[model samples]
Target: MVSFKEIKNDLPAGIVVFLVAVPLCLGIAMASGAPLFSGIIAGFVGGIVVTLISGSQLGVSGPAAGLAVIVLHAIEGLGSYEVFLSAVVLAGAFQLALGFLKAGSIGYYFPSSVIKGMLSGIGVIIILKQIPHAFGYDESYEGSLHFMEPDGKTTFSLLFDAIRYVSPAAVIISGLSLAILIFWEQILSKKGKIFQIIQGPLVVVILGIVLNLLFLNVYPEMALSANHLVELPVADSLGGFFQQFTAPDFSRVLTYEVLFLAGTLAIVASLETLLCLEATDKLDPYKRISPANRELKAQGVGNIVSGLLGGLPVTQVIVRSSANIQSGGRTKLSALIHGVLILGSVIAIPGLLNMIPLASLAAILIVVGYKLAKPALFKSMYRGGWNQFLPFVVTVLAIVFTDLLTGIGIGMVVGIFFILKNSYHVSHTMLTEKTPAGKEKYRMVLAEEVTFLNKGNIMQTLRKIPANAELEIDMSRSAVVDPDVRELIEDYKNTARSNNIKLSIKETAEDEKLEYEGMKF
Candidate 1:
């Protein structure tokens, strides 16, 4: 259950999140090649519907940038966007089943180091992805998360194009917007509550619109073109606005392609949502723990509503969630209010929103990205030592060079390797002594839980045990031993007599017998 406290903080935070979310929603829809209304619908459901169902106070759900490519290809393969909506509906049902089945525990397995890496990696990508837009290059769709694009343009190439064909008007607006955001956040904001209440992102957007309008009237040549400004589909009447929403094509709902794609959507959307949920909780200042199962259920319902309403799949989104936290949101009210603000704006002030420049939004995201990938964060991670640092750096690199999911998978593999290495290298302890007659004696104390991963280290220790010695294998503390490890010890025991060594096995009392794979030893 969410509390209703902190209206002062959450109100401003909600406004900030709403400002940041609008452009992203449109950009993601554009990137997916879907109707512009689809992104807005997903964002709406994620905020209004998901927030009501989710246990997380800070997590913000919406159409995700990570899903842009998958959605793009799926729409193409399904022959029509309406047909794809059926798959999304099925995917939502699948996620709902997963939630009820308690599969949300999968989120607990993500290592902290890898999670931090994902955050930093995404931060870097956000900045890189927004750079071209800041310079007025709109060829690469907004919310494009991958390095490679459908148009055969890489992130760097687009950046180069931005530099080569720079728009002076965009640069001026983005630069000034960046300055104001920094000024408000750094200097003026510390002065009074008014600064925090007004919020820099809102101020930036308004100033951005006003500046562009001034340019249009005074310096006509310097004004941004329609391509550079927001391009939401305008409607003449309330009925026309309602007409924008498309219902799913249920006739093809049972097709194999639809089912397969539905499964794909369920798995990918759920994975992304779980990952974002984990990251959001970690970022929460109060350190509140959210119920993962409940979050999955919320996301499930959000996607179902989104699909039925002709929107994209919904997931908990890190970028908007981080914005909420950074903006000082304290409860789920911020998310709910942001959804309400989204609704109000679309109905009353979309024309005002359409006047805002994309460059100003880019500046806001750049600032958010900078905070997420601060140099100090890297320094702190490096101080955590190689086990943590290696995975962190690898994840950042993989995200920048590859894509989000693949990068996370690569980072997880690296983190798991170090875990196994620790198990293999230090799975036991050995104590050396001398018997009364001066014959060497050795006691190898096994770890509480020894698996096949420790086989090599245990075997090496046995091979080095000298002849004419007394060796004791201690299993008193061991709870479970893998068959491979137990068998290796048994083989060493068999050869002890030939080596002129006496061997003894120390097990726990009969009441607490040593546990071996599938049996008691």
Candidate 2:
């Protein structure tokens, strides 16, 4: 259904996104402690499978760096990679159920401060974890999102270790790679179409290969070992590629641990999808809005297929989506084509891809980490005052100290408490004055919509009246009032009469008797 003009625009963008995704796919997989092919499988399913059913014009889905930490621990906790795949498969089914229930809007319930903190926290972890790989001191493993290393070193100790065991060749490649990426992002990409089209990551990877080759020949001691480069499985034939695909372990499918993990994956993945879809829509020049629930279902299916094929869980990732938007993609065809390109490269040119150094990818991820936890973001959050700053800091610290879900949970608790505390202070207006005949008059004006959450303040106000006070409760402005508040009012009436306090209701809720036990209270 796409026009030729759209195709023309989308094709080049697709290529650009494909170039961008290759390294990220591999890097995220490496960071997740999963097989490199799993990341490719995720991108393939997210792009090709998800896009087909998606209502979004320019959303791109894949293995996100944000989920890398979860996958790493999930694999470790479950004790088998195949068992974890079963969790991922069930997670997709949960997402499908959520989509059917139209729970996509649940993502909006999270506060902006908390969400930003989560991203910032993840960013810090990424930079910290990638430091070892960046400097070529990757003795433990390629993937770790924790401060504590698998080999009994804390994050700071690991940094010291990295300095002690730094590889000159790795330092050179990664340093140069970071330079290229920064130059391309900040300068070259803005100068001309050619630079933008070629993409910095792709250029950096190619340069990394050329530089490594130079080091290998001209200075053997400076050369990166085979372990420092991407080690994608090179297939000799088409069938060999198929042989690499793995199936989930059904034996663990019905376990409580798998189900709980599945639920966690579903909720997190769906939330990330909703957030990315919203951002993508905003970035679209055409101002098209994607259907939230439909996108959830699409992502659900994508995860299911990916899990079935030994892929990591997938989400509508903002990085590739933004890349697509910036590159002028016009349709989902771009995403579809990008997925095709990924599959083709893995099958046909994996040898060339294998030449790309992990240090180059380390540089790319460092930039990503910096962008997420920029100093400017911290300054802005600080300026938003204690309510915002406290949650933000708590979430960031909790994530660095604990884990993603636990950090988010702690942040959410703080955010909800602050919301309720603010609500209690501002839910209504209270006035007290001496009326004629020396009687103290009190008036409580209810807010436009009052819920049970307002009970604490309301109850306090009602109980504070003295025996000689004249009180009037007004609800003329309120459209809806909770029965809990109404009952509190009814309870106050008895006390009013017994204490000889003059009490009158200017207006109760609209149909107070009817609202007490109806479809809505």
Candidate 3:
């Protein structure tokens, strides 16, 4: 069903995404305390396997930074990476169950403000985390999303340290890379076919490699070391490469701890995937809505494959997905190509990949992060009023200060509070006025849908009706009236009778008039 023109557009985009994904896959693996090859395996499966099955055209799936802490802890608890991988396999099975149960609709319940906040928060975290890598401070793992470092340093403290120990060679490479990326995006990309065919990120990567090589020969003192470069596991033979693949230990599959960990991973990975799917769909220029349940199934399959191949658990990663969209990827082909590229690079050009400076990749991600958390977005959200702005700001702050799930949870709580407050106030409309004849008239209009949340307000309104007043309770507009509300209405009718007030119930055409005297509590 894909056309040649679509492939033409996707190829370049895939190259760009491939360039972006390499370091991320490597970095996330390092942060997760897993084998570097595992990250590559996950990326490959996400691209080649998941992309084929996913309904999402622009979304790209891979090992997620959001799961870094969980993976690290799971590995430590299980006492072996192989056992943790078994959990990943079971997690995939759990995700498949969720998809079949139609639980993916949970994504739709996430408030828009919270989702925007999440995007901005992740953007900020990306920029902050990349700062250390950008300045050649390789003490912390690349692709770490935590505000608190594993090495006793906070995110901000790392930035401060990075500035103090900044590498001149890294700074130069990153600076030039950033400048080229900007120029390509703003000017060269619009110039002609040559420019259009070559993506800025790919150019930046090549430049970094070439520049590092030049520095090694010409400016030896300014040359970067292996620690600052991409470190892919190089295999001397095909058998050696195959030997790198790790299989999950099925012996631990029935253990309570393993099953519990698998459930945890499933829930977290599914939530993260759903969130990324929503965010990626929003970022898609075509405005396509990916089927959420289908995405869960695709991700489930990817994780199953990844676990079998000694890879990290997979999710719909926003970072890679956003990179795909930004690079003009229009179909799943781009994702597929990127996967192929990753596999090829690991097999054929690992030494060449290792020559790439982390600084250059950091620069590219810095640009991506900046775009996601643009000042314009903040200004727009602020102007939209507190109802929207509060949740937006809360989500960003929570995400920046904590992990992605915790941040989203906090934002959801704040959003729900606002929802309940509004519901409490607007449950119904009550108006009391005197007619020209000086007769007191009280009119109460029920809300379209009434529930227990409206109970207090309804009771309060009824209690305030003056004695001897002409009261009319209208339920014609209400589609749902809670039982408690109906009981309250009946009780109030009795009270009206005792107060010598005339009370009448106005019902919809489909409703029967209530016999108030016959109604029992």
**TM-scores of all predicted structures:** 0.96, 0.83, 0.95
* Structure candidate 3, residue pairs in collision: none
Answer with 1 or 3, whichever has the higher TM-score.
1
Q: Listing every candidate in turn, what is its Cα RMSD in Å to the true structure after a full C-alpha superposition?
A: 3.5, 5.4, 2.5
lDDT of 2 by residue, 156-251 (tens): 787788899999888998999899888888898789978766767667778889999999899998999888887777888999999889899979
Tens digit per residue, CA lDDT, model 3, 15-83 = 888888988898899989899999999999999889988899988888899999999999988899999
Clashing pairs in 2: none
Ranking by lDDT: 3, 1, 2
Instruction: Say which candidate scores most in TM-score.
Output: 1
Give me the displacement of residue 26 in model 2, in angstroms.
4.7
RMSD of 2: 5.4
Q: Please provide the root mean square deviation of candidate 1 (C-alpha atoms, Å).
A: 3.5
Q: For candidate 1, lDDT tens digit of each residue in 421-505?
A: 8889877999999999998988899999999999999989999998878888888889998999888977776578677777877
Give the whole-model CA lDDT for all candidates, comma-separated.
Answer: 0.89, 0.81, 0.89
